[model samples]
Target: MTTKITWLGHSAFQVETAGKTILLDPFFTGNPAATVSADSVAADAILITHGHGDHIGDTVDIAKRTGALVVANFEIVTWLQGQGLENVHAMHIGGSHAFDFGTVKLTIAHHGSALPDNSYGGNPAGIILKTADGNIYFAGDTALFSDMQLIGDEDLEVAVLPIGDNFTMGPDDSVKATNFLSPRIVIPQHYNTWPLINQDTAAWETNINLQTSATPVVLQVGEHFDLS
Candidate 1:
């Protein structure tokens, strides 16, 4: 079975695999290239890395409309429940949970997770998705850390990382991350939405190719790639 990966701009993505559909950080509403509106996106499950507005964008509306199970840290889950989203599974870092589609392991990430209301948002985490085809690592808004070598030991097929700087790793550090993670393919995200995080993705891809063995995949907003 092949897993289809689609980039919906910013940090949002759709992963289709094993007869299930999963959405990650659905921030499509205000995005210029967002093809589907918040109320129209559907998924069997949704994984949130943190509680930032850009990452949790439209999650409340999307969860209400699709009835997808929301997965994230304990605090975020509790917050979502407080917002009337009942179907949520709260898992802490280093915990793994089995779902209908696959197993999701919460990995470490260096970022803040406070909600806009100034409430404790929960521990930020990256998601490691183990599917039938291969392992996918979504490094949700992080800085370059040495532990990525341990993640690389898992033999990941694809790694979705942020190269947007300011909020996450910049292009140079992302290149280092690619070398440490050593995934077969690397997809850059969390850039170009606003001026604060704007980046030249094409140049970043070239720099990564030169600095690491991993192949860099640059996806336009709403573009999909099939990974078998």
Candidate 2:
């Protein structure tokens, strides 16, 4: 089995594996850099890392249209429920659940989460996807932390991290994260969508390759990469 990972610009990604297509942080409706529109996105499941507007973009609209199961933290689930969405799974950090395609585990992420309506969004989280192809870690909007070494124990094939500064870890700290996780491949995201987070992925890749054993895979918006 192979996992096809698609970068939808910024932190949004479309992952296809085991006959299922999952959307992570599907923020595209208002995304200036999004290549695909919300109406065209098809998802078996929608995984959310936080409740920020940019991260939670079009979740309710997409779920309503596609009936995709919305997997998120308690607060997000509750908020979605209030919006009359019945297909929702409420899980918190350190929780894992199995679906038709594979298993998903929510990990710790250092960030704030307030819903679009300004309600508490619970603890932010990262996502670990275990599939037939390999284990993938989506470190959604996180800073560099020492426990990343622990996440490396899963024998990760790919680690998708944020290299944009201001709101998330800069290239320097993200380079440190790559060394700690030491995954076979690393992809940088969450940058260049806005002026505040504009970054040079080429320069960041150079830093990562020089400092860590992992190879950096940089993708253009709307590009797809397959995992071996």
Per-prediction CA RMSD (Å): 1.1, 0.8
> In candidate 2, which residue pairs get closer than 3 Å at backbone N, Cα or C atoms, i.e. clash?
none
What is the Cα root-mean-square deviation between model 1 and the actual structure? 1.1
Candidate 1: clashing pairs of residues: none
Best by TM-score: 2
lDDT of 1 by residue, 141-190 (tens): 99999999999987899999999999899999999999999999999998
Give TM per candidate: 0.97, 0.98
Query: Which residue runs of candidate 1 sit more than 4 Å off their true CA positions?
Result: none
Separate clash counts for every candidate: 0, 0
lDDT of 2 by residue, 188-223 (tens): 999999899999888998888888999999999989
